[model samples]
Target: RLSNVLKRFARRHPDVALTLRTATSAEVSDLIRRGEATIGLRYDRDRSRDLDCEVLFAEPLGVVCAPDHPLAGRRVGKLADLRDERWIAFPEVPGRREITASHVFALFLTHGLGEVAWTPVDSLTAQKRLVEAGLGIALLSQSNAAEELGSSRIATIRVGDLAASHEVVAVTRHGGFLSAASRRLLDILRADFTKARGTNASRRNGVRRA
Candidate 1:
């Protein structure tokens, strides 16, 4: 989503050197903490104490399944309603934060559903493929599954009590110096998110971030 904005920034600042790296949120936070990167953007709340975080947006998440699945198109009112359903799990990388998995488990625990069943898949694409094959449902960000939902390839199963979401944030070392270019990029990101929030509020009666 920020691809266009990044391209524009590069074009506008031809003399400035920019390097983009994609990694897990934990790894990104570590890079910034160690002075390897000036700034980082990621999903989920940062647990690192050495960085400052600015939440840019909140993305709603939902249970998703193949269009032909039994629970497809259904709004689950309780987590218990899904206790018997099989799930496609995202493998938790050791020593790293697994926000989605943790959130899903927490929701289950809240409703007294103990140790739900799942088949683990490490890759997001593979997980989606498994869901497409009607293997199992998976929890996913609505935005990430928008295309599939629109095409009827998959459907979001809304759990009334499951208000699952993640905050997208820009992070920087708490006590570190931010180069002028990094500050400028961060400013552009904040401005872009502000504009998005206003546009969303007008169209949806709420800001993009909940």
Candidate 2:
């Protein structure tokens, strides 16, 4: 979803240099606070007064798994049924911020399934790949793995207790200057998300492999 907005940004501002560094939401906020980056996009809101945060949109989260998995096209009646399944998620640890795996892992614990099996993977692409390889299932946004879902390379399972969503927020240093190029990119991002908010809903309303 963000790639399309960036493609447009690149075409319109060919002279602008775009460097992307991916990290957890807190790390992204820290990068901006220390001036390592001018603008950052991340999941969830940052409470720090040091940065200006704008929520771009909220994305629905769901389980992702291999296409041929037993739960691929089926509805999960109870969360306990997944206790024996290996999950590709983050292991709860200190200073762990919820954005990727932590949020997914918390879902299980919230339901009293604290001992659920999970594999820690930091990269989003790698999580999807591992799911495809049948290593484990993952909780992810539909748009995050749109291509795989569209191609039937992965599938989504309807877990009644796992209905959740996370916000995509844009952050920048609170009292810092934004270059013309940076402002332009922000404008494009906002406009792109506004236009896409509706269609993206329909496209991912009933999908996933987890």
Best by lDDT: 2
Q: How much is 184 displaced in model 1, in angstroms?
A: 1.7
Q: Model 2 TM-score?
A: 0.79
- Models 1 onward score TM values of 0.80, 0.79
Candidate 1 Cα outliers beyond 4 Å, as residue runs: 93-95, 150-152, 197-210
Clashing pairs in 1: none
Runs of candidate 2 with Cα error greater than 4 angstroms are 78-80, 93-102, 109-115, 200-210
lDDT of 1 by residue, 25-74 (tens): 77888888889989888776686688899998776678999888777888
| 88 Cα displacement, candidate 1 (Å) | 2.0
- Model 2: per-residue Cα lDDT over 95-181, one tens digit each: 445444567556778888766777888677888899999889888876777899999889988887666878888999999999999
- Give model 1's TM-score versus the native structure: 0.80
